[model samples]
Target: MNNVMGIALSGMRVAQQGVQVAAHNVANLATPDAQRLQLKRSAVEQGGVQASVTPAGVDAAAQLGDLLAAKAEVVAFAANATVIRRQDQMLGSLLDREA
Candidate 1:
């Protein structure tokens, strides 16, 4: 196909973007409030972001969206966890005191 080089080059660019996005995610992984992000790509026909055969999952843009969703979940869990943990600890203390 005449578009092979174009495809190859496009794939490289997407891969580069993926690497950068992954690095960004790694940078924030340690942060409790931080989230990971990446874009999604596909070798789709008609204006598709050409990608290699690796299923082209989790590109930078998609990653951002995922990050937000994950953060929301984390926030929810953190809220519940904190309250539950504190309640459990307080209950334990009360029981110990009574005993």
Candidate 2:
């Protein structure tokens, strides 16, 4: 359904933002007084998900944990995308058969 696609797309965007935040943290590792950033997730009132970036402070261990979590998020995003693709393909096949 369209809602499913919207949710999956939002999830992908969150995962992408998380990956970007992790990369930024790694890039600024050597910079003095650098603040680590993280993506915060929330459900949309209309029935989807959304994310916002926030400062997480400067803790290396926490940042590492966040990076690992972000990797898992990326995996989840990939799985969702695959499901969406398969669903689209199945719908197309059904339409073709009907035609």
Candidate 3:
């Protein structure tokens, strides 16, 4: 329950970070000195995942692809959250029935 929610929340956080990085890359397209950034995610030792920002090159096609990927990540995060909500609801219903 808590573990599942934690994983979903971590995924949402990473997705948000990805979206921010993509938007930043798109916004700074014209800045010559700007260093394109990317969000990297890694699984934590305890559970969930964590995100980090790393330097990336400014390539138009790659940036576009990153935007699309971020969009997909958002959708995935939403789905994960939904699963957690549904699981929580089911647990509540079960507890109510038991009571």
Best candidate according to lDDT: 3
Candidate 3 TM-score, C-alpha based: 0.86
How far out, in Å, is residue 11 in model 3? 0.8
Pairs that collide in candidate 1 are 38-59, 38-60, 38-63, 39-59, 39-60, 39-61, 40-59
Q: What would the per-residue lDDT of candidate 1 be over residues 29-74, giving only the tens digit for each residue? A: 5576655554566765743254332323434565455456445534
**Tens digit per residue, CA lDDT, model 3, 44-89:** 8868899999998657597668778778877977887897888799
Q: Rank the candidates by TM-score, best first.
A: 3, 2, 1
Model 3, C-alpha of 54: deviation from truth (Å): 0.9
Please give each candidate's TM-score: 0.42, 0.85, 0.86
Better of 2 and 3 by TM-score: 3
Ranking by lDDT: 3, 2, 1
Model 3's alpha-carbon lDDT is 0.83
Model 3 poorest ten-residue lDDT run: 57-66
